[model samples]
Target: MDYKDYYKVMGVERSATQDEIKRAYRKLARKYHPDVNKEAGSEAKFKELGEAYEVLKDPEKRAAYDQLGSNWRAGQDFQPPPDWGAGFEQRGGMPGNEADFSDFFEALFARSAGGARRAGAGQGGPGAQGMHLRGQDHHAQILIDLEDAYRGATRTLNLRMPEVDAQGHVVTRERTLRVQIPKGVRAGQHIRLAGQGAPGLGEGGAGDLYLEIGFNPHGLYRVEGRDVFIDLPLAPWEAALGAEVNVPTPDGKVALKIPPATGSGRRLRLKGRGIPGATPGDLYVVAQVALPPADTEAARSAYRRLQEDFSSFNPRAALYQGAQS
Candidate 1:
């Protein structure tokens, strides 16, 4: 599956607002509409535009697409992440008068398209034109701590969902469930809970719920895949010379060896210290040197002594040399 960069197709930024996207779509739609322009490939361009707008126009679909990560490049080999749309309700309908779409779009969104068409035709409801349909699967995100991934945890989730009632009118209902988060679950991983979503119409089985895992931003740590990173602040002297420090990890504090002449931005790796799994990721401790405030006479004297000791070293010499060159 080739990745589709809808933002690129629509000539808009990823941060483009809804109005901006609409404006861009309208402009391109007018320019590429086959009826208005008989240029070569105009029909194809117009259909592609419609496909892009079909996804970007809807907020829910746009959000689900965005969660796939912005790191993917246009035309890159793309496989939709597993259960990417698990808890999300699929809304039907395409933006334009097109019936056929690209393989990539169909693979990712065709189920929703079918559901929408059936809904528009009044076929998804119970006894709707004498047709029975299974409930739509629901998708949602759950936030957890990095430590929670290291150790399995049980989480309570509260969700508000809409369903048809006895009178055939849709009603919003709150549902809560206690879910167990398995250990080593990475960000964006899905937890499928069977029969926990919207109720089925008539005798149809209830839909399944999918919970996508997300981690709240940790103040001291940043996670990438399974790896974790922390900025360890050290005194200037401690960084300049060797120092044995105990750094915090998800497991606990561990002794970290700081080599002599270590500078700010130097990263020390602790193997197998990240989220536990078959092959655990390493923990990276980034060094950040801290300087004491020159408020007291003792601090001022210490700084003066250090300045005198390294007076021959010119930190700005490289900048001056570059300027001269």
Candidate 2:
């Protein structure tokens, strides 16, 4: 998909404040409005302006858009980076019709709207005058440590909340929250905090805040579902002859026994050692055989002795047979 530079579309600078952006959008919008200018492509130009304004006018969307960086140019081939909108808190619904916006706008903000709808947010639209209506539920993504999923943790998260200031210009206010993360919370799971979202009208109660969980990049392990996987490096001798080695896990280090004749890429399962729960997931230690370098005379001599001992063993025999077949 092509990148649409909203600032360029609205004829504003990247450094333009909310007020400046508003004025620029208004001026361009008036010039491009279909009724005012009957010229060809005027309607398309007007729609483009509206799409740009839709994003630039909202502080939350604008802040998220800016995070995409200033390097992207208009009409350049672009794809959003993974987890681009991970930390920002967004309101429930979008104002305009989805069909009116371009693919670029939809790609960025449409999923948030869909998530809010799926969460049952903004139900029963603002009722009659003076009627008490529930506040809209908010959504955001947060990063946590892999260990935090194994053992519950308390995390402090700073969220950016967008609101119009006294001057009618959008500004972001930082909100810090202390949240409790439950154990066995997998990636993409949400933690709901009641009454933490937008305030209600009149006497209605506040809505909830849904925090989607994600794990920070781990150096030693990779997780899928509740199961965890880790590479266990072993020497050739240790693979050939059974040996016990120390293995690291989320809980702590434990001794793992290697079976004799264990081959590389063989998985050794540790029952119920993964993310803790009623029926816990298993941890798999994948074996990786490490060959010692023959840089020294002693190491070279050892390799020569092993080669002589296993003179009949041809590791490439299968390859030669397959070629002949």
Candidate 3:
């Protein structure tokens, strides 16, 4: 797909504000309107202008589009990355008719306009006789800990949704839901709660709400997919002579056996310690040997003794020879 530069289409900077985008769209729309311009290709240009404004005028759509990154150039061949819309809360309202939008716009915001025609199909909108429409599905992203993936959890979220008021105009309403986080749900996965989205129009059931999974940055752990990693600090003696230590896992602390002559950056794995599933991921501990400060006389004496003990050894001999080569 060719990447559309909405900002360039509207002759505005990528950092332009909502008001700036609106003004640009209005000016371009008037200049390119088919009724006024009558120039060849004026209709297509007008449609393109509307599409750019459709995304840039709204904060949510604009933010979601911007997350595609700024590296792309206008008309560049592009495909959206996986999890493109993973961390956004999108409601089921279209600013204008969806039929006027391009294929790229539809693909990007498909979830929002999933049931647009049926949302208010029969009762009285444009070109309506009487038809039933399924309610539109809504999507949101929720952040959880690595432990929550190991052990199932329930999370509460507050959302503002659109509702049709007595005057038949849409109004925003705050709604809260306690959602379940399934065990072994990895990052970028989704939890679907049935019948939790916008209510159906006539004789149709409510839409489902999809919660996309995201992980909060952990102070002690780093997660990549289902696997987990943590830096394990070890005393110099513990690394050299080997020791049994209690290591923290997603579940709890477990006894880990350190092999003798272990070096810094050595990785040790605990099988089946990561996210639980049919096939579980392992937990890896990266070794980081820490030395005691040689400030006191006793510590300095011990260090001197160690230096004397290993006087025949040259740690940088290999590096020095390599550099000479």
Task: Tell me how many clashing residue pairs each candidate has.
Answer: 5, 0, 0
Q: Backbone clash tally for model 2?
A: 0
lDDT of each: 0.76, 0.85, 0.78
Q: Output the TM-score of candidate 1.
A: 0.63
Supply the TM-score for candidate 3.
0.67
Name the candidate, 2 or 3, with the larger TM-score value: 2
lDDT of 2 at 275: 87
Per-residue accuracy of model 3 over 161-250 as CA lDDT, tens digit each: 444456433344667788788899998786778887666666767777777787877888998878899999999999999999999998
Q: In model 2, which range of ten residues has the least summed lDDT?
A: 114-123
TM-score of candidate 2 on Cα atoms, chains taken together:
0.74
Cα shift from native, residue 235, model 1 (Å)? 0.7
lDDT of 1: 0.76
lDDT of 1 by residue, 1-325 (tens): 7888999999998877777788999999999998999999999989899888888777667766776878989889988765565434433444443566788887676542322223333225345644545656666656788899999999877654444456433344556789999999998687888876555665766666677677877888999989999999998879988899999998999999899888889999999988888998889999999888999999899999999999998978999999999
Candidate number that wins on lDDT, 1 or 3: 3
